[model samples]
Target: MPSVFSALPGAVLDDSGLLHLGSPLVEQRRLAAGEAIAPLGDRAVIAVPGEDRLSWLDSLTSQALTRLDPGVGTELLVLDPQGHVEHAASVVDDGETAWLITDRGDAEGLLAWLRKMRFRLRVDPRAADDEFAVVGGTRSALARVVPATPAGRPLVWIDPWPDVSPGGYGYAAVDPHPGADRDWAEAIVTRDEERRIADAAAAGDLVLAGLTAVDALRVAAWRPRWTTDVDERALPHELDWMRTAVHLDKGCYRGQETVAKVHNLGHPPRRLVALQLDGSDSVLPVHGAAVRVGDESVGTVTSAALHYEEGPIALAIVRRSVAVDAVLTVDTSDGVISAAQEVVVPPDAGRTANIPRMPRLSRRASAQ
Candidate 1:
């Protein structure tokens, strides 16, 4: 197990590499020229027919989605009263309607929550069963649809569909027939072409990972997943997932008070950090292993993975006082994995804002 994560040095780019279907995941699924791979997770398509769709949906989640474009999408988190995240969804609104892709389990809860406030409004958040699809990575099986350029590094979409949004983009799928119910709000992409693109993306070293791999990647990247990173006890700022989860300028919402107080001032009891196991061995630490700083226990490894390229890396939720650059040992079955911190939110967003200057607090928590 300790040998699982060893650094990859100069792994060559294989543009012409053989595309193998069903490699690290499911079989290579194919979609026709004008289609897409099925939408994954708990997704409910919403048709905002009345004048209040945007405002209605916006008032419920962490991000303001009234302006979500026809083609592109953005991620939003529905946080609990304690400010911890509850549900996460990527919303896509064609000119007239919107589709929220979340976990299948979360679909009904979200729908019912919105319906509870339906006091004579024109908008309706219904579960549209339209087949949906997407393509990701560099190229596509659909000759007509070109693969979008990737930013930062080599690409792979969880849905693995051709992404139309790079650095942000919006689109609308309209019907040729006038007043064809505006076909904008209630559709899913499942065309064969879309599938092919998804297939190709998955086939290449580019992985079209299932929810498990995708979730692991999210936590590793320090991006919080709704259920995993959030709960009844967490606060929003602690996760540092603000990029798309919150609107800095938006007014009051259900959990805004908690968000505001945490951001402005306060210490999040915990901090998030990445643990790079010092020694390269196959024995990986289990999820609940105690991370020790000498004799005092300061944290626990929350997520661990033998990265495709980065080796055995773990994400831990630690006490705020634990030094950001502190060296520690994680007790595992294979003796101990020497681990250290890679800056991530401790679920406490503001703790590090006033860096170096110490805050008045309790004595440190340490265990050998």
Candidate 2:
């Protein structure tokens, strides 16, 4: 299905069948001014309804969501038995239903899994993508276009990135991170509301942005997304996702043992890094581009974007052994572009487990 944003003039939809406004700089400025909104075609909705929805979800995912307040936002990650991320969702609950916003490609599989887990539980899981369209922007931008519900509140899921939420950890070195200034939120609008919002933007009554603009801003924020950033072997630690997604003290769930073991005993085998690409050459490395150091492949680019403020930048996952000060290069079809590493997750990032050392017995005493 065509995205609602497609109705706007000069909107260029991307291969994922999503909309892009064709100009990053203009869109970025609009976003900063809270005058821009993007149709999140890549995102879908899942409705979990029933008396046990919150508790059941709490027992199943990485985040502690049982106490999620009404209309409050949170996120969840489903990890495999091996501690690899399987699915991720942005979560919000309206008094009666838990709304899960996830990647469109993962919605079906996620819904199927939820259904299988519904045995004897009071939760009813079903896909609600057709009913709701996700529109992302700052809270103010959404208010300008989307109408409020009968209760006078528009449904919005606030993004909790780069912050150390309860039971979470911040791995970034710098304070007042760029994400702190990014007032990113996604509002769930009805299909008619989406069309109305698009029509308003097209008629110049409101400003509109595309997915590329959102991607560029997200890259700058060091936000780890599921579509481009995740792979079969990806772990939350590598992407520094624990800042918002993982709760270290959360009760046992699938992959909890590995999460605890890795945090306390082992460092993640790979670490995520932000790359300042040398902009001498006008080439942007596509996703999955190889990252190399001294002719050896050490990592792969998960995402790359030409920011409105920052020039060419990228996020890459490299072997944890890679030096923080290493001058790397990204292999693009145009040529190799020099990249300077900015650490997201440090090589030694992990918890210090409390284990009392046993007192040693002297050999002389044993002989006596």
Candidate 3:
């Protein structure tokens, strides 16, 4: 646990072992209004230094980041050889160092992999967990409380969810997307600054929120996270992650062939969906709860939350063959409850666009 969260009153920890406000409703309201900040206990930071840091990362990840400008917010994914998401991170580079904000559980492994691949490069990858803590809020909200970074920049990674970033693609066919207004940002804060913020919150100068509030909002926005929503069989397309994490035309890297093939000629085996769980019992199903269509098991719930406005909501990954209209049931310890499916990544997800080509005159006609 981060020392800063110790100052919070009536804080309850979640399954991720992170502290959150006991009053979820109040926290949710504060968060929605951009008046709260949450200690991102599940997140950690990785520092990449030396001259070739940016170019080396660009050569390895899913995003095109070779020319990334200082203080720019972008994200990238380390993909498996089969194009499955191995790891994902929110990134921002100060003039001298590139900071990666990743799930805490992934930081050590990601650091080791980067070290293995840096045989002769100028990149030095290291975990900075001891020196930095991650705090999350909306960009506008975070602007009011400045955090200090090792590189002296206000190190913030702005989320670009629910939109088609440059060199990315959008597969969901919807206007006024739910996540269009997700202004989430994670700031790397020094321990002293964290304590100062905590003291302010403790003294009634600032409001504090918990992970429950954050996750609930993320569910409502149909945002996919690396830790909860991913399994061994997960594909980027299933989560509609191509909207930001993938660059379709970037130079070859690991899994590029599989990513290209699936986009152009194949469909992902599974798809992500948002579910409105039956709230009659007021019980939220735990993560990994089984989702079934009648007697047959169809999918598994990745994350479940009680939103301020949406009641009980969840994100589930089900087979692409599952009918969109199916009324599913989630098996919880309390009992089975009905699940109404809302399409996120639809069944026919990987169709390639037919780009029109310009007509070229024949050589014989040109000669004539």
TM-score of each: 0.64, 0.92, 0.92
| Cα distance off (Å), candidate 1, residue 297 | 3.9
Model 3 clash pairs?
A: none
Q: Write the per-residue lDDT of candidate 2 for residues 267-344, one digit (tens) a residue.
A: 889989888787443589999999999899999999988777677788999999999778799998878878877777
Error of 1 at 3 (Å): 32
* TM-score, predicted candidate 1 vs. hidden true structure: 0.64
Q: Residue by residue across 213-322, what tens digits does model 1's lDDT show?
A: 33333444455555444555655555555544576567677777777666666766776666667565466677767888888899777667554434566767678788
Per-residue lDDT of 244 in model 2:
86
**How would you order the candidates by lDDT, starting with the best?**
2, 3, 1
Compared with the true structure, the alpha-carbon lDDT of candidate 2 equals 0.82
Position 233, candidate 2: lDDT: 95
Error of 1 at 317 (Å): 1.8
**Model 2 residue 127 CA deviation in Å:** 0.9
- lDDT winner between 1 and 2, please give it: 2
